[model samples]
Target: MSLNIYHEARSEPQIGQLAVAHVTLNRASQSKQTVEQVVTAPKQFSWTFLQKSYVPKETDIFVDCIQTAMKAMTSKDFTKGATFYHRHDVRPKWAQSKTYVAKYGEHLFYRN
Candidate 1:
């Protein structure tokens, strides 16, 4: 989960990292899968599909992501149950049907 948050939203602010973390948690709960399953599922998180090492190189940022992942587990979800998100620069076809929830840092959040 920390790796997902780091690779996906490391450039984002703390709030955005939290949002991504919550999306992971929300997906896990909704899909009846564990966090690892939700994170490693095919085509779910881009980092998983990208042909590269999963090791986090930025130690400081990775630590921050780990903290964000922990905080998200106990904090109230400000995303209002967003199950999907994408970087602000791209528009995925799937996003057209999902309700726009909010934007935090470089990511936009959505929910079905």
Candidate 2:
């Protein structure tokens, strides 16, 4: 099994959609299933853990990076918005490890 990540264009420019990278799973239990695991924006994730010193802005580049990374992992092609990481202090260790990295300009953020 694999996880895919990609991006899609929304009706508005600022409001982007960070969709699944779209991966094909090789499972004996079933033929195929397309699941949409929606998540919050990357910036939103950071606010939970970051301080006043760190501020994150949403950018197309950052979103693209997330999509690229997810596609690379799943080997599936998609044009969805990129994936990003947010840090919340109360989360578990396993949850934190399931994050993906998205880069905005010169900065990078993690996505779950």
Candidate 3:
């Protein structure tokens, strides 16, 4: 979860990181899967497959992600139950049918 938050939203603001984490949690809850299952499921998080290495290169940022993940576990989701998200710079075909939620940092959030 920390890795997902770090890779996906490390460059984004703190709220963005928390939003991504909440999406992961929401997916896990909705799918009746563990967070690990949701995170490791194929094609769920781009960084899990797109990156050659899972090792985090930025220690400080990684630590911040860990803290964010912890906070997300108990924080009231500000994403309005968003289950999907994509970066603002790209348009994914799947997003066309999703319910648009709020944007936090660089990511556009959605729910089905």
Candidate 4:
């Protein structure tokens, strides 16, 4: 399984992109049966399910928020388009706290 992100720049004011994931499965098996004394049968079955998440950035908050929103997003919100933004003040736990103010309209993006 793997994830792929594609950017589609439709207009200057619009940030366009698409993120997708691909999954593939393979299976193999060997069986043997003997037909004697009223016949006999052998059967086997196996399957696997895998899930993976993809995000635009590696930041902890970004991934966390995306997963959160995706889980909470409704069918309409997903179908139309919904964007989630974070403040510029957002920082990872490893970073030291600092007093900084972000300019207006610093964090923004379009989502679908």
State the RMSD for candidate 4: 21.1
Cα lDDT tens digits for candidate 1, 1-112: 9999988989988988999999999999899999999999999999899864689899998998888999999899888999999988998999999999999989999999
For residues 20-111, could you state the per-residue lDDT of candidate 3 as single tens digits?
Answer: 99999999999999999999899989988886468899999999999999999988988989999999999999999999999999999999
State the lDDT at 40 in candidate 4: 14
Candidate 2 per-residue lDDT over residues 1-112, each given as its tens digit: 1112222221212212222222111111123332322222233233223442222244554555455545445554232223332222234454456444443322233433
| Model 1 CA lDDT for position 87 | 89
Q: What is the C-alpha lDDT of each candidate?
A: 0.92, 0.31, 0.93, 0.22
In candidate 4, how many Å is residue 4 off? Answer: 8.5
Using all chains and alpha carbons, the TM-scores for the candidates as numbered come to 0.97, 0.21, 0.97, 0.16
**Backbone clashes, each candidate:** 0, 16, 0, 0
lDDT: worst 10-residue window of model 4 = 20-29
Model 1 lDDT, full chain set: 0.92
Which of the two candidates, 3 or 4, achieves a greater lDDT against the reference?
3
